[model samples]
Target chain A: MKLKQLEGLLGNLDQFSAPKIELEQYPTGPHIASRMLYTAENSFEDVSDKVVADFGCGCGTLGIAAALLGADHVIGFDVDADSLEIAYLNAEDLELDVNFVQSDIRNLQCRGKIIDTVVMNPPFGTRNKGVDMDFLSVALKVASQAVYSLHKTTTREYVKKTALREYNAKSAEVLCELRYDVPKLYKFHKKKEVDIAVDLWRFVPTPTVESDV
Target chain B: MRLLTHNMLSSTIKGVSNGFPLTIEAAKVVEKQVDMNSDFLKNIFSKIEWKPFVEAAKTLGFSELPEEDVQPSLLDSHEFLTKFHHALLEIHLEEGALVCPETGRKFPVNKGIPNMLLLEDEV
Candidate 1:
């Protein structure tokens, strides 16, 4: 999608609202917020052939972005019904095929289907601390390989250690991080800054498949 | 499962404050195809935790991530976006076991599914 198209979508932000089922409502900034998805899209360019899952997919942004970038299929999971509705509409607007499901990240069951990759922008826990880890736990459970967004300050070491232990996944730091420029309410201020430093982490499962001898 | 979900899970065996970044002992892994939706992604970009996302992708053998410091305009490039999408959404962990950080609890993953069930004692 062209930048103009994206800009147009953002222009209509007022039309978007939290789904009635959403427990909490949050604003996603237009500038800094979308950068992470762009980064994620860059991260997945080479491996777009795999099935992708967007966990804690608020409004299905990451998942939708993956689809736009080239993933053959994208599945988005979230607990908020209102967000899911917006996500679904966004998918339709973009003319991209995506699957959005309303489910909690902590207690999700994927049946038996393994996805190629998983991407998400889970809760940061500013309002609710310790919630980001919950999103990560679910990601480790479902994906063979995955990438996630995290705060630069507190979660750096924790993210690395978690990947190492859970998926045997390693960490490679990305150069450009998205620093939130302002508080959520005053996000439009543009001058105010929140500095939500972001990092893109990759997780690959150990190869258990035996090669032909 | 997405890395975002993995970051929060821990072996809740009684009182383990730092049960995070569960270790994955994947026995089998697979990758499937899915659709794309750019508009949706564009919306959530600011909210993502990119650092850990990159770290997790590397563990999955996806080392090709752009520099975090690069400007946003770079994201407009198809070449850049494609690679980002692959790492963020492609690699899959079909089956594996998740070991808790604090406790040596092993959660089994069957058929690309993780059974995060804890035993009576562990719980």
Candidate 2:
């Protein structure tokens, strides 16, 4: 299926009844999800036949779309049961096979199976500083191949530095940018929708030993 | 929790290194017939560790899975695939406790969802 079509389908997925602000639970827009998947497909080892994980999956957008796009298996991890409830319903509605796990990312662990790729939009730590790093740490640990995460553009230096220095990540790059629409879910926000600059980062664990150039 | 999910889960409690393959103590196991997709089974085959999967299956009382050395040739075998299907997808714990290998902390699985939450102090 084309990315545009998948985005349209993802748009129809059930949303949170009452979105939570603390978790920074703004759903990943379908366009971003599409772009992420498109990059994973053409550039990274295609998600097809791979074990893909959606970290901090809000309403199962990334994970569900991956499954529909032929990820051999997809796991959607979210702490909120309400969000997961909607995620599960959305999966059923789409008739897609996805396992929605309800748990905090910091507390969750994966064992017998290693995740091939992770796609997530973790909190930018606007509310609680450094929480985004927790998501990054967990994603790094779970993924065997690569991680794609959305973060505040201002945090590029810290995230990139930490990705390389602390995690021994071999490759790190800003894949693209998406203008994030922050809906008025919190009291601090006076506007109905606020736009923020977010950067998409791709980090991988191992360096390619053979360089063509 | 589906063993597929179980295969990807470990205990993350404090000071518990090697928390992988959390031993399953299944109080309740559920068997539902999900449509078999051989391609997906094949795709996920490499990711599923053999010993833990066999042990987890046996622990839950689905003994049809072969003991060891699941041959690549067997991956194509319908009979083996059927058994593989049962162990991997069909039988999953509905109510259980995933006991940490090191810390012995028991993460409870209620209604097929394992609560992997740690107390704030544990972090």
Candidate 3:
């Protein structure tokens, strides 16, 4: 699909009706989401005909994008059941067959290298420290091909260091930086809207001996 | 959830070792047709645990998958690929529970999404 067309479809999907502070739920805008998936498919061939997963899939935006891009199978994982409900409705509206599971990303007990690619907009760890790292850690393990995620631009050095050294990733590269428009979803936000610079990262995991074992 | 998701998932409650291939309690099963891709099925064939996959398919009332482990060359067969595609992606557990093998704890599946979150104590 054309990038413009993909963005148009994602623009119509439902977002969080009630944002949760603890989970740091922020809707992934169509602009960033379309660019992320478009790059993954066009540049790296990670979406189409591959098993793609969306971690902490809020309202199923990224996963649905993968489905629209012709992913063979798409599974969305999220801890919030209410968000999953909205995600389910979103997929139904698009007439896309995406599977969803209600489980915390940290505690997900996925075995083997069943998934090819993982796309997510994880919590930036503002509420709970290191939660973003935790999501990256699991995504590295579950995905066999690559993991595409967004993190704060300020933490670029930290994210690269930890992903390579601690998570044992093969390679971590920042694809691009985009402005994350955070609307006033919570009372803590003093401004009507704030644009935070966030980096889109693509991390390739080191091949494991236990792959598909 | 589709069996593709089920095949990758395990019981994640703390202290439960080897909580794989969670038993299926199928209260309701639905089939949603999807376009078949032989290459995709072929790539995922080696990654799947065949016994559990066949067992799960039987539980969902489709017993066409070979019970024994088969060679990857079988993926070339159109009939086998069709069955594999249906069992893996088409059959949906609309309403059911996935019970952990170790603790027998039930994780409910509602609206086709499995709830695998554990209590704080379990975690």
Which one wins on lDDT? Answer: 3
Query: Whole-model Cα lDDT per candidate?
Result: 0.57, 0.80, 0.94
Runs of candidate 3 exceeding 4 Å displacement = none
Question: What is the number of residue pairs that collide in model 3?
Answer: 0
* Candidate 3: tens digits of C-alpha lDDT, residues A1-213: 899999999999999999899999999999999999999999999999999999999899999999999999999999999899999999999899999999999998677889889999999999899999999999998899999999999999999999999999999999999999998999999999999999999999988887532
C-alpha RMSD over true interface residues, model 3 = 1.4
In candidate 2, position B48 carries an lDDT of: 78
Candidate ordering by DockQ (highest first): 3, 2, 1
C-alpha lDDT (0 to 100) for residue B110 of candidate 3:
94
DockQ of 3: 0.79
lDDT-superior candidate, 2 or 3: 3
Relative to the real complex, the DockQ score for model 2 comes to 0.47
Q: Which candidate is the best by TM-score?
A: 3
- Using alpha carbons, what is the TM-score of model 3? 0.99
Residue range A1-213, candidate 2, lDDT tens digits: 887888899888877778888887787888888888878877876587778899989899888878887786688888887788788788879877687677898777776336788888887888778888888887877777788899889888988999889877878899898898877777888999999989989988663333110
Measured against the true two-chain complex, the DockQ scores of the candidates, in the order shown, are: 0.03, 0.47, 0.79
**TM-score of model 2 vs. true structure:** 0.87
lDDT of 3: 0.94
TM-score of each: 0.53, 0.87, 0.99
Question: Comparing to the true complex, what docking class would candidate 3 get?
Answer: medium
